[model samples]
Target: MDFGFGPEDEELRGRARAWLTEHLAGPYADIRGLGGPGSEHEAVAPRRAWERELGRGGWIGQGWEAEGYGNRRLSLTGQVVWAEEYAALRAPARVGHIGENLLAPTLIAYGSPEQRDRFLPAIARGEELWCQGYSEPGAGSDLAGVRTAAVREPRGGAAGLLRVTGQKIWTSLAREADWCFVLARTEAGSRRHRGLSFLLVRMDQPGRVEVRPIRQMSGTSEFNEVFFDGAVAEEVVGGEGNGWTVAMGLLALERGVSTLVQQIGFAAELERVLASYAASHTAPGAEDAVLRDRLVQQWAQLRTMRWNALRTLGASPDPGAPSVAKLLWGGWHRRLGELAVAVRGAAASAGPADWAPGTPYENGLDEAQRLFLFTRADTIYGGSDEIQRNIIAERVLGLPKESR
Candidate 1:
C-alpha cells in the first residue's frame, strides 16, 4: 500500500505545523511536552488553557463531520497530518482527547441529537473535559464484569435521572474532567455484558461524585479512583441496555488516527534515548555492541509499526486490529523504557538527595529514570498484554475460548 501523502495532505501538514508553531508560544510555551502519560500532573492550569487555545484554532475535533460544532471537518488523512504535526511539535498533551477522539465519534455514530447538541459544542470549544468510567476495580480488563449500577429514578421530575453508584479505577483525567461516560448495569440480576447502559454523568455533583488520585510508583497521580454515589446521569447513548455495543465500538475507535500520533511521540522518545546513549560515554554498556544493535532494532521496529498503522488506517473492520496495535506500541514503549534505563546504567538508579514531599517526580529524576519507571505499567493500563493476545486468538484466529 502506498504510504506517501498527496499534495493536499502535504499542504495540511504544512498548515498544521505552522499553526502549532505560531500559537504554541507565550503562556503555552512551557507546556510543550507536559501533560503526557505519567507526567500528567505537570502544568495543569496551563494545559487546560492550552486546550482552549487549540479550540480557538478549530483544531480540537478535526475528524468530526458534524455541522455547527465549531469543528472543521477534515479527511482522515488530514486528521493524520494534524496529529503528526502536533506530536512532532511536542504540543501539550490533549486534555480533550477522550471527548474529541472517543466520545465525539461515538456520539456521531450512536448518540442522540440532543446529546450531540448538549455536549459536542462544549467539547469542541475545549470548555469541558471528559473521563471514561468504564474500568472498575473488578472489571479492568474483563469489562463485561462491571457491577456499577445506574438505577433510573422513577418519581417526579427525577424520572429521567439515572442514579449511578459504583467505583471506577484507573480513570485518567478524572479530577480534571467535567463529565464521565459511565458503563453501568441498568438491569438487576444482569449477567456479563447484558443489561448495560452507556450513561453520561456530570462530575460536579457535589455530594454524589468523588475523585481520589492514585499515586503510582513513578510518584504521579495521573490515574484516579472515581466513586459515584447516586450520581445523576441524564443522557444515555445508543439507548439504555445497549452499552456493551457502544463501549465495544468506542474501544474499536481507539485504533484510529491516534495510533499514528502515538507512534510520532514514541519516535520522539526513541530519539531522545538515542541522544542520551550517544552522550553517555561514561555509562556502562553504552559502548556495547549488543546495546547498539538493540537501538537499531528499536528504530527498525518503530518504522514497521508506523507502516502497519498507516496500512490499517480506515481499513475494513478487523476484530484484532486495535488489539494488535495496542500490543505492538505497549510492548515497544515498555522496552524503550528499559533501554533508556539500561543506557544510563548506574546513573539511572541515583536521584536527587533532597527530594521533597508533594513534588513532581521529574523534579528529582532525569527523563530516562522517569520513563523507565512510568512505562512499567504501559502494557497493564490500556488492556494487558494477556488480554490483547486473547482478543487476537479468539476473535481473529477463531481459537477456542479460554476456560474461564
Candidate 2:
C-alpha cells in the first residue's frame, strides 16, 4: 500500500494540475467531468464537446481497451490519481455518468458485439446520457423484490423487445436522461433475484416513459420518480436472466468507485473547514469546542472511507465492502452537516460560504442540514446498513449466515 507515485505518475499529476489551473476558472461551483449544463436540460452538444476534448486528449476513459471505446489500460493508481486531483479541484459530479459508471463495465464484461460497438464510443464521447432504473415501489432496499415486468413482445421486431411496465423511485438525474438501464422482472412467475432482468430503454421514445422529480429537502429535484409504460423494446446489458447479477454489479460500482469521489471530496471539504475554522478565531465556548471536536471526528470518518475504498478497489472484490463505504459516508456526511450548522449558528441554514449572495454561510449550513436529513437513506439504498453489516459479519468476519 505504497501511496507514493512513480516518476511517470508524478509527471502526469504535474501536467494535470497545470491543465486544471489554466482551464477551470470563475464561479463554476458545480462542474463534473463531461456532463450537461444541469439535470433539467438535455445537454447533448455541451456534453459531447467535453467528451471529445477528453477522448481526443485520452483523458476520459480509464481501464478500458483502446480504439474500441476510449482510453486504454488505465492503471489503478492512475484512476486513484484522477479521482484525487478531480476531488482536489472540487469539480461537481459528472453528467451522463450513470452509463459511464454502471453500464460501461457491464458492456466490457458481457455486452454483445453490436451493443459495445453502438454504445461505447458515444458513451465515451458523452454524446448520449444514461440513468439507472432499479428501485421500484416494492423494491428499494430489497432490490431483489423488483416487480417491473419486461415481458417479451410476441411479435418482436428487435432482439430483446421487452415491454417494461412498472414504477421506479429516487431516480436521480433522470428527467432529461436520453437512456436508462432498467432492471425488470423478466422471468415471470419466478422467485426473487432469480427472475429479474436488466433492460436498457431508449427514454427519448414517447408513450413509453414518464419522469417526475422528487423535490428533496434541499428544494432541488436531484431525486426523481420515473414511470414506464408497456411500449417499445429495450436493450439488455450483460445478458437476459442475468439482471440480478448485473444490477448487483452496478450497485457495487455505484457504492464503490463511482462514490469514491464523494469520500475524497468530503475529506477535502473537511480540510477547507479546518482552515476556515482556524482563521476565524472564534471565542472559546463549550458548545464551540464540542462542535469543533465533532468536525474533527468527521474528518477522521472521511479518511476511513477513503482508506476503505482504496483497499477494496486495490484488493479483494468483497461484495459487501461498498456497503461499508456507503454507510460510513452517509453517517459522516450527517455529522459534518450538523457541525457545519452549529458553526454557522443562525445563518447555517441558509447557504454555503461565498457560494451565493446574502448569507451563503447560512445557505451552506442549510445545504448541510438537507444533506444530513438525506443521509438517513444512505445505508438503505444500494442495500441497507443492516444488510452491509450482515455481509461483513458473514463474509469478511467469517460469521455464519442467519438461518432464516
Candidate 3:
C-alpha cells in the first residue's frame, strides 16, 4: 500500500497545524507539552479547557461524519494527518479521548438512535468528559473476569435505570471525568464473559459514587480507584448481558488512529532522551556502543510500528493486531524509560535534595526520572504482556487454552 499522503491530506495537515498554532495562545500557551501518559496530572484544568478548544475548532471527532453529528468525515489518511500534526505541535494531552475515541465510535456502531442523540452532541461539543470503568479489583487485564454488578431499577419515568455496585481500579481520569462507561455483571449466576452489560454512569452522585486517586511513582494520580455503591447508570450501550461484545468492540476501536498519535508522542520522548545523552557529561557509558545501537533499534522499531498501524488502519478487526500493538509499544516504551534514566548515569538514582525545613519536597524527580518510574507498569496495566501473549497464542494461533 502507498504510504505517502496525497495533496489533499497535506492541505488538511497544514490546516490542523495552523489552527493549533493560532489557538494555542493565552493561558494555553504554557501547556504545549504539559499533559501526556506519565504527566496526565499536570495542568488538569488547562488541559480540559484545551479539549473544549479542540471541539470548538471541530478537531475532536476527525473520523465521524458531518451528517449526523456535524463532524468532519475525513478519510483514514486525513485522520492520521490530523493526529500526527496534533502530536508534532505538542498540543496538550487530550482529556476527551476516551469519549471521542472509544465511547463515541462504539455508540455510533451499536447505540440506539436516542443514545447517539443524547451522548454524541455533548461529546462533540467537549462539554462532558468520560472515563472507562472496565478493570475491577480482580480484573485488570482479564476483562471477562469483571464482577461489578448492575441491577436494573425504575426511577420515576425512566424505565431502565441501573444501580451499579462494584469497584473499578486503574481507571484513568476517574476523578476528573463527568461520566464513565462501566462494564459490569448484569446477570445472576453468570461466569466469565457471560451476564455482563455496558452501563453509562454519571460520576456526580455524592454518596453513590466514590473516586480515590491512585498515586503513581511518577508523582501523579491520573489513575484512580472508583467505587460504586448503588450508583446510577442512565443508559446501556449494547444492551444487557452483551457487555462482553460491546467491551470487545470498544477495545477494538482503541487500536485505531490514536495508536499513531501515541507513536508520535513516543518519538518526542525518544528525542528528549537522545538530547539528554548528548548533553550529559556523566562518564562514557552514555557513549556506549550497545546503548547507541539499542537507541537506533528503538527508532527503527517505532517506524515499523507506525507503518504497520497505517497499513492496518482501515482493515477489518484482527484480534491479534491490538494485542501485538500493545506488546510492541508497551515493551518499547518501558525500554525507552529504562534507557532514559540510564543515560543520566549516577545522578539517576537520587533527586534534588530539599534543604529548607517545613517543606514537602524531597523526591522531586525530573521528566526523565518520572518517565522511568511510570513506564515500569507499561506492560502490566491495560493488558499485561503475558496476557497479550496468551491471547495471540489461543485466539490468533488457534492453540489450546491454558488452564486457569
Candidate 4:
C-alpha cells in the first residue's frame, strides 16, 4: 500500500511547516518543547496561551467535516501533515487536545446540533480546555464499570439539570481544563454499561466540583482526582442511557492521525537516545553487544510501528486496530525508557549533586530520569496490556469471553 503523501498533501505539509516557524516566535518561542507527556506540569500558564495561539491559526480542529467552527476542514492526510510538522517543531504539548481530538469528534458524531453549536466553537477557538472524566477509582480500563451517577431534578422538565455526584481519578489536565465530559449513570438500578449517560460538565463549580492533583513518581501532578458533588450537567450526548455507545465511539477515534503524530514524537526520542549512546563510549555496558542490538531493534521496531500505523490509517473499522496500536506503542515506549537509562550506565541512577530533599520533582532529575519514571505507567494507562489482549481476543478473534 502506498502511504506516501500526494502533491496536495505535500503543499499542505509545506504550509504547516511555514506556519509553525512563523508563529513559534517571541512569546511562544521558549515554549517549544514544554508540556509533553512526562512534562505536562511545565509552563502551565504559557501552554494554555499557546493553545489559544493554535486556535487563532486554525490548527485545532482540522479533521471535522462541519463548517463555521473556527476550524479549517482538512483531509485526513492534511491533518497528518499538520501533526507531523507540529511535532517536528516541538510545539508546546496541546492543552486543548481532549476537546479538539476526542470530545469535539464525539460531539460531532453523536451530539445534538445545539450541543455542537454550544461547545465546538469554543473548542475550536481554544477558549475552553477539556479533561476526560471517564476513569474512576475502580474503573480505569474497565470503562463499563463506571459508577458515577447523574440525576435530573423534577422541576425543570426534560431540559432539567442533571446533578452529577461521583469521583474520577487519573484525569489528565483536570487542573487546567475549563470543562469535562463525564460518563455517568442516570438510572437508579443500572449495572455495568447499562443506563449510562455521557454528560458535559463545567469544571468551575466552586463547591460542587473539586480537583486535587495526584503526584506521580515523576514528581509531576498532571493527573488529578476530580470530585463532582451535585455538579451541573446540562447536556448529554447521544441521549440519556446511551453513554456506552458514545464513549466507545470516542475511543475508536483515538486511532486516527494522533497515532501518526505520536510516532513522530517517538522517532525524535529515539534519535536523542541514539545520540546519548554515541556519547556514552566510556560508560559501562554502553559497549555491550546486547545493548547495541537492543538499540538497533528499537529503531527497527519504531519504523515498523510507523508503517503499520500508515497502512491502517483510514481503513475500515477494525475492532482490534486501536487495541493493537495501543499494545505496540505502549510496550515500545516502556522499553525505550528502560533503554534510555541503560545506555547512560551508573550516571542514570543518580540525581544532580546539589539536589536537596525539599526541592521540587522537576528540578531534581534530568530528562532521562523523568522519562524512565513516567514511562513506567505507559502500559498501565490508556489501556493495560492485559486489557488490550482481551479486547483482541474477544472482539476480533471470535474467542470466548473471559469467565467473569
Candidate 5:
C-alpha cells in the first residue's frame, strides 16, 4: 500500500504547523513541552487554557463526521498530518484528548441525538473535560470483572437518575475532569460483561464524588483513585443493560488514529534520548558497540511501528488489532526508557537530592528517571501482556479459550 501523502496533505500539515507556531508563544511558550503521561501534573493552568485555544482554532475533534460538530471534515490522511504537526511543534499535552478522541467518537457512534446535542458542543468548545471510569479496583485488565454498581433512583420531577457507588483505580485526569463516562453493573446478579450500563456522571457533585491523586514513583500524581458514593448520572448511553456492547465499541475506536498520533509523541521522546546520548562524553555506554547497535535498532523499530499503524488505519475490523498495537508500543516504550537511562551509565542509578527542604526523603528523580519508572506500568495498566496475547490467540488465531 502506498503511504505517500498528496499535496493536499502537505498543505494541511503546513496549516496545522503554522497555527501551532503562532499560538505557542508569549506566556504559553514555557508550557510547550509540559503535561504528558507521567508529567501531567506540570503547568495545569496553562494547559487548560491551551485547550480553549485549540477549541477556538477548531483543532479539536477533527475526525468526527457530524456536521457543525467539528470545524471541518478532515480526511484520515489530513488528520494524521495534523497530529504529526501538533506533536512536532511540542504543543502542550492536550487536556481534551480523552473527550475529543475517545468519548466524543463513542457518543457520535452510539449516543442519542439529545445526548449528542448536549455533550458534543461542550466537548468541541473544550469548556468541559472528561475522564474514563472503566478500570475499577478489581477490574484493571479484565474489564468484565467490573463491579461498580449503579441503581436507578426515581425522582419526582425528572426522569430518574442512576446512583453510582464504587471506587475506580488508576483513572487518568480524574481530578481535573469535569465529567466521567462510567461503565457500571446496572442489573442485579449480572456476571462478567453483561448487565452493564454506560453512564455519564458529573465529577464535581460535592460530597457524592471524590478524586484522590495516586502519587507514582516518578513523584507525579497523574493517575487517581476516584470514589463514587451515591453519585448521580441521568444520561445512560446506549441504554441500560447494553453497556457491554457500547463499551466494546468504544474500545475498538480507541485504536487507529489515536495510536498513530501517539507514535508522533513517541518519536519526540526517542529524539530526546538520542540527543542525550550525543551530549554525553564520558558516559559508560557512550562508545559501547552493543549499546550503539541497540540505539540504531530503536530508531528502526519506531519507523516500523509508524508504518504498521498507518497500514492499520481504516483497515478491516480485526478483533486483535488494538491488542496487537498495545503489545507492540508498550514493550517498545519500556525498552526505550531503559535505553535512556543505560546510556548515562552508573550516574542514572542515583537520583538528585530533594531540593525542597521540607520534603520527605532525599531521592529526587529527573525526567529520565521518571520515564524509566513510569513506562514500567505501560504494559500492565492498559491491558497486560498476558491479556493481549490471549486476545490474539483466541480471537484472531481461532484458538481455544484459556482455562479460567
Candidate 6:
C-alpha cells in the first residue's frame, strides 16, 4: 500500500507544523494539566478553554464538513497533520472527545434538526461537554448483552423520555458531563440486539442517578461508574430497537479516528520518556541497550500507525483498521511502561521523584511507573486483543467466526 501523502498532504503537514510550533507554547507544555494523571480538579473551565482555543483556531473536529465548518472542511491529511502536531505540542486531549468523536458524526448521520441544532455547534465550540454511557457491568465487552432498559413511555410523544435504568461502567468524565449518549433496551422480551435504543440523556437533572469515580492506577477516577435507577432520557435518536447500530457506530468512532489521535498523543509521551532517558544515560549496561532498541522500534510503530490511519482516512472508515491500531497501541504503551520501569530501577519505589527528564525526576519516573502498571489492561478494554484478532480473522481474512 502506498502510504505516502500527496503534494497537498505535504503542504498541509507543513502548514500544521508551522501553526503548532507558533501556537503551542508557554503554560500548555506541562503534560499533566491536559487530562493527564496529575491534573487538578477544575469544574469545566479547563475543557472550555481548550475547546475555545481549538475552535478559534479552527482546529477542533477536522473532518467536519464545509457546511459544518462555515463552508469549508479540513482534508483528511490535514486532520492527520493536526493530530500529529497537536500531540507534538502536548495540547490537552480534546475535552470534547465524546462530542467530536462519538456523538457529532452520529448526529450528522441520524440526529434530527433539533438534535443537531441543540448539540453540534456547542460541541464544535466546546460549550457543552458529553460522555458515553455504553458499557454496563454485564455488557462491558459483550455489547449485545446490554441489559440497560429504555422503556418507551406510553401515551406520550415518541420525542418522549425513555425511562433509562441500568449501570454504565468505565464512563470517562462523568462528573462534569452535560449530556450522555446511552444505549438500553426499549422493547421488553426482544432479542439481545433487537429492542435496544440509543438515547441522549441530560445529566444535569436527576431522577435516581449515582456517579462514583473508579480509581485507576493513576490513583484517580479518571473514569467513573454511573448508575441510573430510572433516569430520564432525552430525545431518542436513531429510533428504538435500532440502538445496536448507533452504539456500534459510536464504537466505530472510538476504534478509528479517536484511537488514532490517542495513539499519536501516547507516542509523544514516549518521546518525552526517551528524551529523559537519553539525557540520563549512565551506568551503561545491556539492559539500557535493550530498552533503547525497544524505544526505537516504538517510534517506528507510531509512525506506522499514523500512516495506516492516513491510508484508512483517505479511503473509507474501516472498522478493522481502528481495532488494529488500538491493539497495536495497547501493546506499545505497556512496553513503554515496562522499559521505563527497568530504566527507573529502584527509583520507581519512590514514585514521581524518580522521573526527572534525563536526570530521573522522581515524579516523571513515578508517572512512568504508573503508566506501566496501568497499561496491562489496555488490551482488555474497548475490545480485548483476542476479540480484535477474531474480527480481523473473520472479517478481513474471510475466516469463520470463533465458536462460542
User: The CA-based lDDT of model 2 is what?
Assistant: 0.67
Residue 221 of candidate 2: its Cα lDDT? Answer: 57
Clash pairs, model 1 backbone: none
* Cα lDDT tens digits for candidate 6, 59-137: 6667754255331266655566667766766666556777887788888777787888778777777667888888888
- lDDT, each prediction: 0.89, 0.67, 0.86, 0.89, 0.87, 0.72
Cα RMSDs of all predictions? 2.1, 4.5, 2.4, 1.7, 2.2, 4.4
Model 5 per-residue lDDT tens digits across residues 146-224: 9999987766323566799998999998988999999999998999978999999999999999999887766678899
Worst 10 residues of 1 by lDDT: 152-161
- TM-score list, all predictions: 0.95, 0.84, 0.95, 0.96, 0.95, 0.86
Q: Who wins the TM-score comparison?
A: 4
**Residue-wise C-alpha lDDT for candidate 3, range 1-404, written one tens digit per residue:** 46888999999988988998999898999999887777778888989988888778877777764356846778888888888888888888889999999999999888999999998888988889999999988888888998899887745434666799999999888888999999999898899999999899999999999999886655577789999999988899888889899999889889778888899999999999988877874676546887788889888999999988887775677889999999999999999999998887778887667525443222477777888888999999888999999999999999999998
Better of 1 and 3 by TM-score: 1
lDDT, candidate 1, 1-404, per-residue tens: 45777899999888889999999889888888887887888888889988888888898888776888999888877877888888888898988889999999999999989989998999988999999999998999889999999887777444567799999999999999999999999999999989999999999999999999998877778899999999999789998889999999999887788888888889999999999889886667538888889999999999999888888875777889999999999999999999999998887887778876767555677899889999998898878999999999999999999998
Backbone clash count, each prediction separately: 0, 11, 0, 0, 0, 14
Off by over 4 Å in 1: 156-158, 282-286, 355-362
In model 2, what is the error at residue 377, expressed in angstroms? 3.4
Cα deviation at 347, candidate 5, in Å, is 0.6
* Superior by TM-score: candidate 2 or candidate 5: 5
TM-score-superior candidate, 5 or 6:
5
